[model samples]
Target: MRHAVVIIHGIGEQKPMDTLRGFVSSVTRNQGTDGKNIEFYSKPDELSNLFELRRLTTASAEDEGRVKTDFFEYYWAYNVRDTKVQQVLTWIWQILFRWPWSLPKRIRPFHIAIWFIIFASLALILSGYDIPFMGEDQPMWIGAIGTLLTAMLSYLFTGYVGDAARYTSPSPGNIAERQKIRKDGIMLLKSLHESNKYEKIILVGHSLGAIIGYDIIRNLWSEYNTKYVDGKYKDQLLKFEKDYAQPENVALNIKPYQSAQEDLLYQQNDGGNPWRITHFITLGSPLTHASFLLAKNISELKERMKERELPKSPPVFEVIKNINRFTYLPDFKKPGRVLHHSAPFACTQWINVYYENDYVGGNLSEYFGKGIREHKIKIKGSPWLRFVPFLSHTHYWSDDGNLKRCEASLAILTSIIWDKKMPEKDEKEKQTVQPDANELAGLEL
Candidate 1:
């Protein structure tokens, strides 16, 4: 079956295709020689790829049965730039002092350190600090002016790229902005899946992008359940969508979810939701910091814990619930595969990869509950480098010709996405898939 992967990048002033190219390089290096083993096709619109299966060779065979993989980069940093500066200023303030209060004890120090750096740098700049015998022996006031300009530029940089500023803010506008981005991402996935080009889908999100990815999956499945599984907002949504969702000149790839089981069944067996998320991969994610940067006040995590409620990490809980909602049936009409009863969860698996020293990365297993896979790789770097919060955070999946970290991380990631596992005769069975061609692709595109 064909596979599609969506890559969501974290906060940054990113150039188009920069993240995509780097990611492709990393995965390519890890897989084998670049152009020979992993060929990447850059598309005119957005997505690009050609992840070759080791066993699949000839051009026609590769296109027909091999694991054909495509990559799409979900970009939203540009949207944040258009937001009001006042909102960003408020976010800067919260990030400096208030946000740390909401962080877990383990990660609070990193947050605190980051806060100190921001304010301290600004203070030092404002104080007119100057290098010895430099800048044409500029006046102290001139230094201050230069620093002030620098500070403004820095603020703009952080505001534009620091997705956390928008994501974690309590402002309704910021929240709405984030929701819009997630909606766009979800719609993209819907089209990609409905194109009937991919059977298994995997989403890879890094840093704040992981949080965005989490929301997309969480909301996409929730919407699907409401319209397809539970059958709540069916006809109204369908009728409204026909008039509003599609543009006059454009064609809609995915149809509205139908209320009837027969409709959903037909869509599935026929071509409705042919693809499902087989795996979700997170690298250097700040998912654990969600309640702090994502909520209005003390966050739902603390509220639930204090109130003796579910005590859920909202994103993780939603992901688990959605992944477990339904299973993909490759051959629905087959005698044994047909008539499989509906189950509580879907079959999507999550693979979270983090480094011990990553300032923004934290363990998700405690929040992910049992039966979830979590991987931690030892980062080989100068001991002093770990102290640089942002550097360490971004290095997890970066491929600057450094193969160790990328190779280590991709080893586990590839295993989850491309490994082979036999189908269970029934839903009650639990099995580990082999980390080979058979596990995932079955050499089938």
Candidate 2:
């Protein structure tokens, strides 16, 4: 009956340990578990190494000199297991409590108001000052003044805006930083599994963490054969072997059928059992699509156009050949296709919870446009909410309706983790249970 939860946070947000705790507690209560036999392990600080690594890699040449210093700082900061756990708890508290207080520090309303006033004043001055048209007499000073004001605003705001965006953007670096983070995350998971002899472990991730979760599971499956060694999941491995059998084994062992990287991990001598990860839940993920349409679409369009323009007439063959030479070619990788966003949906072992109204990266259309366009999209319908609407990628965890959807999704996932059959409820069936008001108010640090 030993069960554990590993919660990873989304981008631009610190670890969501508190949110997870609340969600877990709420679900357990709803399910009448009463938090009796559940063990929660939140590792918010485990990613500090990742953050530092990102910082070092992203820093300019002058700052790169201190990469080693930053690395050591992270090593010392996150080296201890207990300390990492405490850091996670601390981060949970900060997110649930300190975030509101610190909001002003990040973005002061007064500063915003002042900037608004300045922009308003400039606009008024510009409106009053006129510019001359080709045949009309107008105050030409207005255009000059407006341009000057715009230039001034650009000069003052450029760096601030850039930095703000950077704060939100994931670290842009070569493969090393990503590899380090992935390695660290896997190591942390392995350590946790070793420390806690949980029969079942669930990894839950939001945004980038979702990608990390996929990598971890893929790595695990790739490394260990289907055998649970000792009390360490050797049984599950044997079960898989018995269930899938030899032909399936051949399929898994074959390359291109399974990713080469995944195959390598499967063959690796990691003692950790990949199949131990019973369930993975991803929220507001954007893994299936490229960040830019140009990366995915332009080439597709070119191919389509080329096919259409393939000379039907023999006389037009030379003309078509010349046309092909001038066709547009897109650099697919330069725009960086959104990786791991589709992992949750695409993964057989994972359950995905999407939100309605995720502004930045929530729309499946952005990533799975071809599916929608081709009318090939299908989702397992929920009785509680027949349809989960697309929401802003970042807001899914916070929105009330979406949160309920997430809860329902987690309930289903929990059932999967326990290997219990999901109780079928008709579309008309409703659980009118209200959240415990006392528990909501009773969330102390």
Judging by lDDT against the true structure, name the best candidate: 1
lDDT of 2 at 215: 61
Which candidate comes out best when scored by TM-score? 1
**Model 1: residues >4 Å from true position, as ranges?**
30-36, 44-66, 83-86, 95-102, 111-149, 152-162, 226-275, 296-299, 302-346, 384-387, 420-445
The local distance difference test score of each candidate is 0.54, 0.36
What TM-scores do the predictions have? 0.64, 0.39
User: Candidate 2 on 301-348: residue-level lDDT in tens?
Assistant: 334323432111000111232221111112332221111211221112
Give per-candidate clash totals: 17, 28
- Candidate 2 has an lDDT of 0.36
The residue-by-residue lDDT of candidate 1 on 179-283, one tens digit each, is: 778777888778776677766677899988888887776656643432233223223222222222222234322212111221323233332234366567888
Clashes of 2: 28
